[model samples]
Target: MKVGFATQDLKRVDAHFGWAKNIAVYEVTPEGHSFVEAFVFAGDLQEDGNEDKLQPKLDAIKDCAILYVAAIGGSGAARVVAQNIHPMKVNQPEEISGLLDKLQDVLKGSPPPWLRKVMGKGQERKFEFEEEV
Candidate 1:
């Protein structure tokens, strides 16, 4: 399954879903995982009144089974869930590599029901970042 990490520095998952400028995606499996791509935020930073700001981010990561972030606004989380994308909240910034390692271990073993569901849906087609709006 493909997992997306909200990160500002590429080395760690330290950004909120609404504020992350870059998101790292990876194809994860029990045996291993590899970096798939990074979705760069194209929308404006000042999102004060633009409720639609989450659209682009959603479009970019539509293929991901889940998203890891430091935080997510209630509405944004709703939108993600509405799209069938699972949102995971991390209490603190975490190293992307370490996180992936732990996830791989889970993948190697028997994953919980929700995770199994996400893995099952991971085969969906992905939208090209540049081609899509």
Candidate 2:
């Protein structure tokens, strides 16, 4: 799956989803992860409710399964969720590489239900008790 990180310096997930100067994308798997691409934005990106700026950012991560950010607005999060992209918020700046490693570890282990859903394996299972005789 693809993952995106919102960062000002492209080193950490330290920027708001709306104001991030750069969005670094990576291809992640249980084996490992690697950088895929990055999207750069300029001009005013402050929190002023300018929804237009979000389009390009959305386009950048259209194929991403997850996004990491320091913060995100309600509308921004809604838009991301509408696109089937999961947004993760961090309380403070976190290294993108560290996050990737952790995600890889999770992929190696038993990921949570939501994560499995994001990984495109969310099919509902019917247990024996639920099967109609």
Say which candidate scores most in TM-score: 2
**At residue 6, what lDDT does model 1 achieve?**
89
Against the reference, the lDDT scores of all candidates come to 0.87, 0.93
Q: Which ten residues in a row have the lowest lDDT in candidate 1?
A: 42-51
Residue 95 C-alpha lDDT in model 2:
96
Query: What would the TM-score be for candidate 1 when compared with the true structure?
Result: 0.86
TM-score of each: 0.86, 0.90
* Residue 106 local lDDT, model 1: 97
For candidate 2, give the lDDT of residue 8. 97
lDDT, candidate 1, 5-43, per-residue tens: 989898899998888889899988999989999988765
Query: Which pairs clash in the backbone of model 1?
Result: none
